[model samples]
Target: MSFSLFRASVRRAATAPRAQLRSQLRIPLRKFSTPPPEAPVPTPKSNTTLYVGIGAVVAAAGVAFYSFSDSGSNAVKTGVQAAKVKANFVPTKEDYQKVYSRIAGIFDDAGDYDDGSYAPIILRLAWHSSGTYDKESKTGGSNYATMRFAPESQHGANAGLNVARDLMENIKKEFSWISYGDLWTLGGVAAVQEMNGPKIPWRPGRVDGVQTQATPDGRLPDASQGSDHLRKIFGRMGFNDQEIVALSGGHAVGRCHSNRSGFDGPWTFSPTTMTNDFFKLLFDEKWVWKKWNGPKQLEDKGTQSLMMLPTDYVLVQDKIFKKHARAYADDEALFFKDFAASCAKLFELGVPTEQWVSPEPWIMKNVDEK
Candidate 1:
């Protein structure tokens, strides 16, 4: 008989009801065995047939034991165990969208937080986690999500990020299967989209790494530094002048905390919404040094309520950076397009192309769309 037919027979016998199996077992063991008087000398073809028959018999016997040896419940339990082994959980885009929805729901839950929204800090967490990338050494970046460990988490640039981390921990508990790198970056994407920013195309594949993989300190930018420092830092991550200017537009939403960065105040009037107002205010008004005991930062002369970091001020001071900044200030649509592209690149740093689940990034819909 063909092997396929033999296997099909075995499957039918294994799945038979317990009473049927008992009756079949009683039919006769001698019927399946070769008669001693008529048995031929062993040959390759005969041996192969004998082995296949033996295997089928053994398989059917094991299945019968599991199915009827104890109770009907045992048979169901065995089937479940086999099914579990055959089905492994793989998250799809819809699963990721559910995660995105959860994050967006919690953005404004904290009444005491800056601007009454967790969106800024969540975006910062994604930024700092990814900003650690070193193109030459391939040491840092979002691939590992190493900020959960020490040294990197304790880095000066990461101060007050614990709030962001703690906030994400809650989300992690709810979606236990997601890696930290994917979760944090997804949080950033959700924050941007919910705040009316550009639709950042995203995909999932990043895996969690150990403490030994944590990047060294100073990989992130220093807010006190100027244009040269900006170039050296972002350049290390393989970003150009235009990309740097485009990324700086992120300052439009978040404010500095005295307890965190030492320099205090929001970069724009609306510290919660996404807008090109940061660029507009950068050139539209004069910036003067804020007279404070804190670290040196610039304040708008018009209202003095808004603030800009030394790194931010350098964009207008440096000619190349100024050219791009001028363009963004003139065109909000262009700023959104560039920001989405560059930020998507930043979030995907250190992740291998093969690890991505999708050929193209997914543009997750905003919560309002749902």
Candidate 2:
């Protein structure tokens, strides 16, 4: 009744239920080993529930997206609209002519400015704003109205440019369609032309860019720099020997302020006039090192009132620059032509070829001429 019966019971359990238990384990293994049965292909009759379930998921996703994205969506839409408004605006040449004449009317009434005119400083605004261009990176320049950003405005080179910019702001209010780049540059042109200088062929269509697009400081030529540095800075702008000589003629107008440029005094006797006088002075005068508590600069030996940047002195020291400088000095007409071309080039720097307001620049008639 003990061992024999126990053995018989074990054999019965193994043969009968044990095989079934093994079969059950194998069934699970085989089920996993093979692919589970294909999901039943949705039948037309069954698709209603399936479609309803899918539609519910999609609708929920749509609601979630709309709720979360509302602010961002509105921002994008507003930005696009603002861009469109800017794009559609096309100020006529006549409208610009009005701006050109109006800017000519703004002179130094306060007697607080240099040369008894805001014209010189106004010209410098165009100069500094457009001067930031790098033909390589195509950054800087007036295209961004970049001086409006503090980073460019704070640069020592651009120190007093706010006076120029603020003067133009009055004009900006009247002609809202005009970009600051165009206004400032046009002001430069008008200053030259109205001051009895050459006709600066001008155009518009510089779009305002943001602060991220602002060029880093020191791109403008340091008055402290020599010929080699001038070559590196201006050459980067694609200016040639003749162009550099011509551009220096802008010194004919503006004065260097100790508070602004850290160098004080006018370049020529007539700081109000843009002329070959700068070239004449560059060649004909004696420039002695200025002895001052301020930054190092050169004073005209005969008259300590005038100043010359080292970069300016380089024009004569470098033979290539001297030739053009002498040529511009010899012929006032030639100086006017080259200076006009250089001003046009400087204003156009960093502007994409396609972005110009005109295919060929306009020779805006001076108020007297008009």
Candidate 3:
């Protein structure tokens, strides 16, 4: 009986009521073989936030640098204190005229220097100084007053300019601020206008320069050469046929000294006034070769009194150049305008940008006005 009862009890224990066995094991019925879901890792979003913060810091730094640089540049530009110019520093048309009169006075007093007057050579000085510009390269212009320097002052074409410059020194003593660049150009204008030429629109922007700025002397036209040589030389300085003819009109005022350019006499009868006489004489006169021991310059066959350089003769020979010369011969006004414009440009070569006042052109008056 005991064995049977024990066996029954063991069976009852082994296969006890499921609820009772669950309670004893303390395990839930749903906990069979499924795996538990993992808790999500806490990945940070800080990488993107860090990048944005760094970018903002870099942008702020860049803005700060640009502001500093611009302010420094502005300070430099404004530092000249150009505002402090003295009351007497201001110019008047009369002042310009005085300068012109001074130049004219020198021309009148030609008996003071070499071979009588130095007016002709002074004209050459202004011509050579301005004739070296090349527009394409922007290398030359009256801006720098480079003719004050050595190689430029010593140029063969400029051989006699020193005498003229020396003569003008007296005028400089009276008006120290007017740069030599301005004086040379103004002198040319004065000589032309007083001689009955058109009123040139002159200005005073060229600053006097040191010897280092003097341009090489050969920059001017060679009186002994033909049209091809003239073109090459003037072309280097940026003159077209029209400009060349206009510039040649300067011959209307001054004479070609036998001792200077090796040609003798003035082209026009009235060598002191600006006129169409140069073209008139070129067209009206019968130009024959001068038979002197001097260079091969042309002489007026009718009078045997006036002369023309080979370069001057080419003006009539070239069809294009001849057209303007004939026009100027007929109309003094056109010659005046052209000569003034071209000559003004010539005087401004190599000028510095900063020294330029407003970059606008102004009229320069003669001495009577001063």
- Whole-structure CA lDDT of model 3: 0.56
Clashing residue pairs in candidate 1 are none
Give per-candidate clash totals. 0, 0, 34
Estimate the TM-score for candidate 2. 0.76
Q: After superposition, how far is residue 318 of candidate 1 from its true place, in Å?
A: 0.5
Tens digits of per-residue lDDT for model 1 on 1-370?
A: 0000000001111133323533544521110111112222233222333333323332343355355433354344334433322233344566677788878888767565565567878888888889889999987888768898787888878887788899888877676656678899999898787767999999876756656678988778887888888889899999999999998888877677776667676776565668898899999989999999998888988778767788888889999999999999999999999999999999999987655666678899887674
| lDDT of the candidates, in the order given | 0.71, 0.66, 0.56
What would the per-residue lDDT of candidate 2 be over residues 1-370, giving only the tens digit for each residue? 0000000001111112323533543421110011222322233232233333333332343344334433454233324424433343234566677788778777534253444567777777788787778877767777657777667778877776677778888877666545667888999898888666899888765765555567888777777777888777788888888888888887776667666666666676655556788889988898999998987778887757677777788899998989999999999999999889988989888876656645678889777663
Candidate 3 Cα deviation (angstroms), residue 139: 4.1
Worst 10 residues of 2 by lDDT: 1-10
How far does residue 339 in candidate 1 sit from its true spot (Å)?
0.2
